[model samples]
Target: MYPQRDVRVRHARDLAFSLLTPEDAFELLAFEIAERAWFEQHIEARREQFYTPHGMSQHIIECLALNAQGRMSPLLIRHKGVIIGRANLHDIDQNSARVGYRLAENACGQGIAHKALNHLMKEARCIYGLDTLTATVSVDNKASQRVLEKAKFTVVDKLPTYSQVVDQRLGCVVYQCALREKVECP
Candidate 1:
């Protein structure tokens, strides 16, 4: 469905957003391995297979299939051509989609996550003709919650015992954003 392996979506300062492709396997693997522990702090850990080369290849193929089916968009966030994070629009339908994203440990606190999310919102709104987007944030992840709020997402509900990480249970907040041509941000 895609003419090129890595089609650029848009750029946010030095950060580039692009459709994920098979060629991204190596760098993406390195990024995932380096940030595994850091990511697990705010979210549940991924399966061990995800850190393997073969596993990543399979994952990318599945993601591209969904992208081709027009049910999802898997994006890689890069800085200076290096993978630093990811943002994805999943479960896309006629009027809504679920959005999720993560940034590397070193990339945190740099406003990159929020910027990437906003760009994803644009894609969902304009490109996909979506009317709403939803995201779930772990209750303990205050930073992400704040970003969602700043992006105009409203809390609609909460999921109890949303995730099990190691020995702890983390509840999650469900947020929904209504798409608008103009997004007011401070």
Candidate 2:
């Protein structure tokens, strides 16, 4: 399990992931607003309330609560001190967790996500004692698939209409990373 405190991980010169907190609500809101259109095309549709600062503050509070319970690790992805997007390890179960990430439109194709995910995987093993990490990507999101593949995740399953994005149901491809033998766990 993670320690009873926030963790900030820096993967490269300008890329890092910091544990989310209530104080980050405004920056999160700004990131959401900037990436809303780009992200809506891939992930499930977010509620209108999620676009507001008040709603995001509540969301951050809930995430922190989950973090306290060792059920989730909500992190804000930053590039040179600006919140670029989010990277989360949620649905944490014994020795396993689900990972997901979103980057600003301008940050795409820069190998940032790959480095960030690699760092997260290391943290998952060392901090959370997680041996397995899973991620689900929309079938149409080939870029994300590439990122996962580059991070050593293998395609393990496919789901028909796994989630609803906007008005359409999108198929998903599930990827799994087995790190039990790759990392030393406490």
Q: Evaluate all candidate structures by whole-model CA lDDT and list the values in order.
A: 0.86, 0.83
Candidate 2 Cα deviation (angstroms), residue 153: 1.0
Worst 10 residues of 1 by lDDT: 1-10
Q: Pick the lDDT winner.
A: 1
The sequence of per-residue lDDT tens digits that candidate 1 reaches over residues 58-109 is: 9999999999999999999988787889999999999999999998777777
Native RMSD of candidate 1 (Å): 6.2
Against the true structure, candidate 2 reaches a TM-score of 0.89
**Candidate 2, residue 2: CA error in Å?**
35
lDDT (Cα, tens digit) per residue for candidate 2, span 152-181: 899999999999998999999999999876
